[model samples]
Target: MYILLALISAIFAAIYFYYKQSFTYWQSRGVPHLTPSMPFGNLNKPWSIPLVDQVTKQYKIFKKRGERQAGFYLMTEPIYIPIDPEFVKNVMIKDFHHFTDRGLYVNDEAQPVIGNLFFSDGQKWKNLRQKLTPTFTSGKMKMMFNTMMNCTVPLQESIGQIADNNETFDAKDVMSKYTTDVIGSCAFGIECNSFKDPDSDFRKYGRLMFEENAIKAMKFLFSLSFGNLAKKIGLKNMEPEVAEFFTKVAVDTYNYRIKNNVKRNDFMQLLIDMMDKDNNGGQKSNFLTMNDFVAQVILFFVAGFDTSSVTLSFTLFTLASHQDIQGKLRQEIKNVLKKYNGEITYDALQEMKYMEQVINETMRLYPIAPVLGRVCTQNYTMPSTNLVIEKGTKVFIPNWGLQRDPDYFPDPDKFDPERFSDENKGSIDPGTYLPFGEGPRICIGLRFAMMQMKMCLAALLKDYEFRMNPKTIVPLQLGFGFVISVKGGIWLNVKRIS
Candidate 1:
């Protein structure tokens, strides 16, 4: 028993010394850093506190100290945080080549679905990005416009009923269903009918993908911090059941389309066409396998449904709190639709410039992706600084902090859409407002997400006026998850516009 205890003591001592050495990394490099603690490092109560909140808090602290850059630790792993927009611009846009990869955990051999463009790196990412770029073009968005509009019918009906009944409902839940149906139809070419059948497979699996628990949080941190080691042990970024469901859906959709020679204007058809082209005579570099196809499909569904829903919910919540802004937005929607013969067409949606401003303001206040992540692919010196960020180092851009900084946005907490008006928007710094991120690696589905959001808001705002429900907690407490979400949910009362 004494021998065993000595061995255990030795192991613990070694771990303590190792962490102590690791914690001094940023200090040795002449960078400002927050003090790190055992096990969790600077990430205190990670499972309880949202990662975005922690990072944003850190960003503010460093910025207030008049520092342009700072460092923090995620466990023993060092993360570089750039407080200056110039550094952010260099990392994301001007010097993007050195930081092309997101540095996420990807073990495609074990979890084939993890091989999607979002998680991939280097040559594979370049090839896949090249092939998929055409899929999200403005012309393609125009093609998928009608399909997006169709999904809003159920949304309008559900909200209209709530308006007529003058009932308070969870805006998050309603928007989630709306986006689920939209993504299901546009990405999978299936009608989700999430409003009618809340337990539908698409909705079930979509929820499963983003559902966070302590175990999931631990797995995510583990995989992110020790990516190679996790990959060696076959750690997966997604639940097996969720991966299997999305895979089967993609397979069934692809096979049915190919066998019957059916072609639709949605994303699945475009993917199928690409696969068919690759199989026939496409260049080897551009070829996509079945795993590749399913991976992209899953990426589309996950990103498409969740982020847009969160943005829509927050937009409604903001508009509810500011009745004057809501009224002006509703009037813009009405005016834009009037010019299009009272039909919500793609062109008409574009003409609603103020609606764009409203959404931008909401995203600024409550960005769905509050932080942007990247890994240094090569040793590069930060411009105008003597320090060099080593290769493989993780870097975080505090999207939430930058967007809400009083320096960039005057009266930062206010929900004023005029901040994004054409006359004033250009004055805002380039790298500061990253609701959809910036640069080549910026969100590929941004236009699609914007269209879905605008269509939903345009559809509902035309007939319904929403107000905050007392049930909603004021000074909204955000929840822990991959995206920005309310702790409980955003509840709003709906009344028909007379």
Candidate 2:
């Protein structure tokens, strides 16, 4: 018993000493840092709050300390958060080569889902990004516009039913179903019919993909704290079930498309064509395997659907909350549609300048990705500072904190779309307003996502008026998850225009 106790004591002592050394990393380097708690590092409880909120809180703390750059430990790992816009510009653009990889938890061999463009790093990400960039261009989007518009037919009809019943519904769920159907048709070349059948597998699996239960949440936190160790133990970035479901769906879809000799002007077709070329030994500038194809499709479906749905839902919620703004936006949509003969087209969608401003403002208040992360690819010295960020150091750009800063955006809490008006937009700083991020590694699907949101908003606003539902919690409390989602959903009541 004494021998066992001694061994246990030695193990604990080693761990404690190691953590002490690790926690002193930023301090030794002459960097301001948040004082870290033992075992959990800077976080008192690793899972105490939602990840988004935690990062935002840290951003506020570091900003209030009057520091341009500060460091904090997630467990033993040091993460650098840059508060200055100049520093953000350097990291995102000028010195981007030194900060290429997102430093996300990705283990393709262990979890194929992480092989997607979002998580993959180094040359793989570059190649995949180059290959997929053209897939979302204006011409490509125009080709897929009809398919996306078709999905909105069901969206309008379903929302019309709710308006008829005079019942409040979860706008998030409703918007998600519309996006699910859009992604199903556009990304996978299949009909989801989610509006007609809410329990469709596409909707179920998509919801499950984003669902953050306790166990999965803990695992995600663990991975963030101990990435190398987590990867060693084969800890997946996605839930096992989510990874499995998406992988299967990707594979089945690919096989079906190839077997049927299917070709459609959508994301899935582009991926399939790439795979076909590789199989046929055609010109191989950037050949894609079946796995790569599936990964890109899944990335498009997951990232595009969730973020856009949340954006659309929040736009509606905010519009409902402020009836005057909603009226103004609805009027703009009405005027734009009249020019195109009551038809919502890509051209008409773009003409709703005020609606675009509303989305911009909505995103500023509740940016889909509250914090963006990058890992140092090589040792980088700040241009004007003595601080040297070591290779492998994780860097965070606090999207929420920066966008909500009163200095950049006066009266930040107020939902004011004029802040994004053409006259006012030019006054905003270059790097201060990155709803879709900045630089080469910026979101490739920005055009597609904007197109999706515009069409849905235009269609909905043209026919129906919305107000906040009583079931919703006002002065909204955000969910503490990867994305900025409202807790208990953004409930809204709809009324059909006579």
Candidate 3:
């Protein structure tokens, strides 16, 4: 009985000590904060509700608390959330030298896929990025345009079949298949008929990439719950099977092409040429290893397949909901395509200014990375403050909340494509808009994603009219897994316009 009483007293004392430690964090720095209670710290919501929603709520608190930045704990670790956009811009771009890494571990030796651009940091990232930049230039994109177009022809045929069958389809699912085919053809230099055959290798592997498992879920929670510690255990940002399958696919494809003297004007070909094979473009001979090849193809897959597919899907759904915007976009597409003889050529796609605005608006509301993450490599003192944050502080920019903030965007809940209009957009603050992120580490595949998106939209809008199906959830909620997706997907019924 005495031992039980002693144990209860010890537990309460531990609780009191934790609160004392957490509460003293901000008070000592002269930073303002709501007093934390017991062991939950300031992030109790994250433990109780959906994690994304918890992040969103913290964004609200930081924004309204009138703190330029707030001191808080993700459980026990201290993190700073920059409330003001100016501070965010400064941390992410101006002071980038102090925070060169995303703070995520890259166990490249243990997990090969983690060596890719998304997770790689410091000198290694710089070296790899320098070598790969020329691969996606305007000239190369033009060379690859025909490959994307060839896949689109199949997409159109697939749509025609769907329309004939009165299939009430999830535009998201269909677009995913279209993107899978395009990525397979362009990235791997192989034929993947995802539109005709659901069981294609590309399709299977793509599913493997995003499908969730208990291990993935636990790591996800742990990473958010205890990020730095989670990295020590060698948790990979991508699935192991996905990485193994892709590595094998890349090796087999490289071997088959070399042995058979096969060549295609695609990403794989460029990578091989860089290896001193047939070597187009008079590029110097450098041996490209399997990691080098897989990294390049994975970039194509990561950016090409998912982000574009999700962006295009949401745009279609948003346009269906807002007919006025849809009508204006259709007019722009018709005018631009007609200028190039009803074909979406490189130069012609550039002329679709209004279409660009609409896509920008879509990206604004549904940015693929709703938040930007960076880790401080050196101690950072909030501008004008004497408090120095120790190195390794995980910094976050909640683009989802900032983009939707009423101060930055009036009537923040409304879908207003003109928010991105040239005249109106120029008046808005530059730091407020970051759909593709900011600074040296912004998404490198922005142009590639846009070009594919523009082409697909042009083809679909030219021949079809889309309206929301009964299956679509109104005032859509963002899903919790993989990439941000509209819950229940964007279901649409189609009518042939031609």
Candidate 4:
């Protein structure tokens, strides 16, 4: 018994000494840093708090100190959070090559279908990104616009039903259904009809992807901090069922398209073409395998589904809370549609500039992708500093912090769409706004996402009015997890704009 206790004590002592050395990494490099604790780096009870909250808190602290950039740790791994917009631009755009990869751990063996453009790194990412770039082009988006417009039929009808019944509905849940149907049709070339049947397979699986799982979150953090070690232990960020389901759907769709000689002007059809390109007298080397093809489609659906939904829901919430802004948005939508003979066409949607400003303000306040992560791909010196950011160092740009900082955005908490108006928007500095990120790694589907959001918002605002439900908690308490979700969902009462 005495010998066992001594052995345990010795092992702990060794671990303590090792980590103690790691704590001084930033200080040794002459970089300003937050004080770290023994095991969890600078964080105390990190697991007990949401990463978004933690990052935002740290961002406030660093900003208050006027730090251009500050180093901190997540476990033993050092992370550099850049408070300066100049540094942010340098990492995101000016010096993009040095930070090309997001440094995410992919258990390809476990979740092979997850190696999409979003999570892929190095040459693989570059190759995939190059091929996928044309897929989201304006011409391609124009081709898929009709398909997306068809999906909104159920969205409007469902809202009409809700408004007639005078029943309060969860805006997130409602908008998620709309997004699911849109993505299902556009990306997978299927009819999800989530609005008609909320328990549809697409909706069910989509909800599972974002549902808060403590074990999953911990594993994700562990993988991010110690990627090599996590890989050795076979840590996977994607749920097994999710990977399996998406893989099956992708394979079945691909096989069906080939067998029936079917073709559609949707995202899945583009992927199908890429896979069948060799047979269609195209380059074999540029082609994606079944796994690669499926991965991109899944990413398109998953990433676009949740993000667009959250943005739409939050935009409604903002509009609901501020009636005057909502009224202006409705007027813009009404005028634009009248010009196009009441048709919500792509060109007409673009003319709704005030609507765009509203969405921008909503994104600023409740960016679903709260933090932008980048991993240094090479050793590079930060401008005006002797600090050499070593290769493979993870860098975080706290969008949540920068968007809300009083220094950059005066009256940051106020939901003023005028802040994004033509007259006022130029006053805002670049790099301070990155709801969809920037540069080459910028979201390929930005135009499509904006169109979908604008379509939904314009349709609803033109027909109905949204007001905050009594069930909705005041001040909007954020849910614990990665995404900046409202806790218990945002409930809202709907009324027809008669």
> Who wins the lDDT comparison?
1
lDDT, each prediction: 0.91, 0.85, 0.77, 0.87
TM-score list, all predictions: 0.98, 0.97, 0.90, 0.97
User: For model 2, what is the error of residue 400's alpha carbon versus the real structure, in angstroms, after optimal superposition?
Assistant: 1.0
- Candidate 3 lDDT over residue span 295-405, tens digit each: 777867877888889998988988999888888888888888787888878888878888888888888888878767788888887787676867877777777888888
Error of 2 at 57 (Å): 2.6
Model 3: clashing residue pairs? Answer: none
Candidate 3 contains a number of clashing pairs equal to 0
User: Which one wins by lDDT: 3 or 4?
Assistant: 4
Question: Rank order by lDDT, top first?
Answer: 1, 4, 2, 3
How are the candidates ranked when ordered by TM-score, highest leading?
A: 1, 4, 2, 3
TM-score of 3: 0.90
Candidate 4 backbone clash number: 0
Give every collision pair in model 1: none
Single out the weakest 10-residue window by summed lDDT for candidate 4.
279-288
lDDT by residue (tens digit), candidate 1, 142-173: 99999889998989899888887878999889
Clashing pairs in 4: none
Candidate 1 ranges beyond 4 A from true positions: none
